[model samples]
Target: MSADAFIAAGPRPPRAGAVATTATYAWRGLLKVRHVPEQLIDVTIGPILLLVMFTYVFGGAISGTTGDYLQFLLPGILVMGVLLTSVASGVILQADRAAGVVDRFRSLPSWRAAPLVGAVVADSVRYLATAAVILVTGLLLGFDAGGGLLGVLAAALLVTVFAFALSWLFTTLGLVVRGASAVQGIGMMAIFLLVFVSNVFVDPATLPAAVAAFVDVNPVSHLVTAVRTLLAGDPAGADVALALAEAAAVTAVFAPLTARLYGRP
Candidate 1:
């Protein structure tokens, strides 16, 4: 075909098979974790420390006993744990940018966003592992799901889905900021404010009126409330709906934005 013929043919869509390309990159991401085992420590240690300190030290003051507080705190802690882990996605992307990985992806004949999609897939695995650790730790600490097997499973699924959606937000930030330390610093500040001001450690009613109002509308609060309802075997009501809506909104906004900015990173 002549160049003129090709030009006349109009711009062809970048070859489709994004699934395989995404899987390949996802595998690369997993292997990175395997080679650098220390990367796993970030997700593991923080949750454990939070669980131990909260259940042992503050449990008595907050819930009258360790057992009671563990049950009450477990769901909230799970939400916080996954949110913290979400920061890693951004950091990883920042590293990839600095290492010229993004530039290589642009030169390759793969779908423009395949590597990012693959990263997102790998992140799902990471998020699932984090959720599993949280559940097992909660169980070992004497927290039981009154909502039974089905309830716990549903809650876990919901959280993993939300985590996937949330990852896109970080991915976009990585593309925009182009610095790991900057992403980490911003992520830490945002995560801390979101995690602390919500109903994770205490009842919202106990917060001062202005703070409580912010928590009431916070997306993390909705997620924690949904998880707690599921664990307690209570009706999820609209909490699950609200949480899903929040996740969908985030993914809808960030996923495409990240894809568009992937080449720039």
Candidate 2:
């Protein structure tokens, strides 16, 4: 067809819907993983090593038995694994910005937020991978899921939701930070503080009064408790509600901020 005829071939197909655009970008993110399989290390090796080391090195002193500590520790390790993995969302975004991929994304005729939102959505796979590795390793170590398979699934869902929300917060940080390394450094530091200060490795009751007060309200603590409750076969408690609420609140605050700052130079 002549150039004129092609130009006159009527309007191009309608722009993709939000879901379609987002899914396309999400697929693009997954393609990156296929090409660079090393990206799987953080979600796989890192979490497994953490679960094993923490369980063996400190388990006996803390819980009197490796088996008992494994039960208490598995939920927290699951949360920590996924939460730490969530930092990659921002690091990847920062890397994309450096590579000019985000600029190219701006020129595409797709949902404006798709690249940003889709990055987080794609990172969900990493979150799930992290959770799976931890769960499998815990089971191998004789960590019983008192709450059964259904409870295990529920706990995974809750952790994913919390990780998704936290991804947005890190997304915002990615935009504000200048370099991928900077984002990773700052993000990991913050995550370490949050995990250590919470009830992950130790009981808040053993913490200093002021620190315990903070741990009581730390969203990480709430999330870990919710996971523990589900895995323990206990009725869903207020912590479950609090965890969801906190996740919603985080997404509400940071998603828009991420959208706002997304394409800026």
Candidate 3:
């Protein structure tokens, strides 16, 4: 009677598919922000502050007009905003590991990488939100997009892709790092170095030789340049290609590493 009754329950509902498990974990990631709304401050409010402060405080000094500076600054801000938000991938993952949440996921009869991949997928929404908020703010402050709607969408798509790749790198960091704060600190330092060393705030041509060399090679610079070119209606084929390649390389390298580390007992 017991065996027949169990068999009639339909093979334990055939375990969730990969997509279903991934989406469920992704939704779990979003629910964390719903309960703690302040988690979005870095992506939303932080970018707005940076946009306004940088555009107003140094805009006249650098570009001679806040209006003109806004044009140049907005795209860079998008890159910075989304990349910075990506750091949370590592921090939150580390927190989950410490809290035994990840261990629980490991015990489930689902894809092993779903929790990791889904966390990054959920953060992709935060990246898009950051891009949208910053873009809207830039427009309100008199920034214009010459590349039109299609270009803007392309730029947002590129930034999200790059941010997704970068999140994998941070997710690897989460797997290896002993504490959430350590992951956060390292991730922030890494991002700050990338942003500041790139051509985000200045032209590489104007910088000194050694610094300019580094800026010329910075992936963030390529991403910002691609975004700017898209916004300005210019041919960004080469820039976009290079930026995408960089993103692909990051994902190719760290995704496997994260999987390997996450699989460890």
Query: What Cα-based lDDT does every candidate model obtain?
Result: 0.89, 0.92, 0.92
Q: Clashing pairs in model 2?
A: none
Query: On residues 15-78, what C-alpha lDDT tens digit does candidate 1 reach at each position?
Result: 7587888899999999999999898886677778888888999999999999999988999889
Name the top TM-score candidate.
2
The segments of candidate 3 whose C-alpha lies over 4 angstroms from its true place after superposition are 1-11
Clash count (model 1, backbone only)? 0
Task: Compute the lDDT of residue 99 as modeled in candidate 3.
Answer: 96
Could you list the CA RMSD of all candidates, in the order they appear? Answer: 4.9, 1.2, 1.6
Residue 249 error, candidate 1, Å? 0.3
Against the correct fold, how does model 1 do in TM-score?
Answer: 0.92
Tell me each candidate's TM-score.
0.92, 0.97, 0.96
| lDDT of model number 1 | 0.89
Clashes by residue pair, model 1: none
Candidate 3 RMSD to the correct structure: 1.6
What are the per-residue Cα lDDT tens digits for candidate 3 across 1-265? Answer: 6988879976566778899989999999999899999998888899999999999998999889999888988999999998999999999999999999989989988999999888889999999999999888988888899999888889999999999999999999998989999999999999999999988887788899999999988899999999999989899999999999999999999999999999988
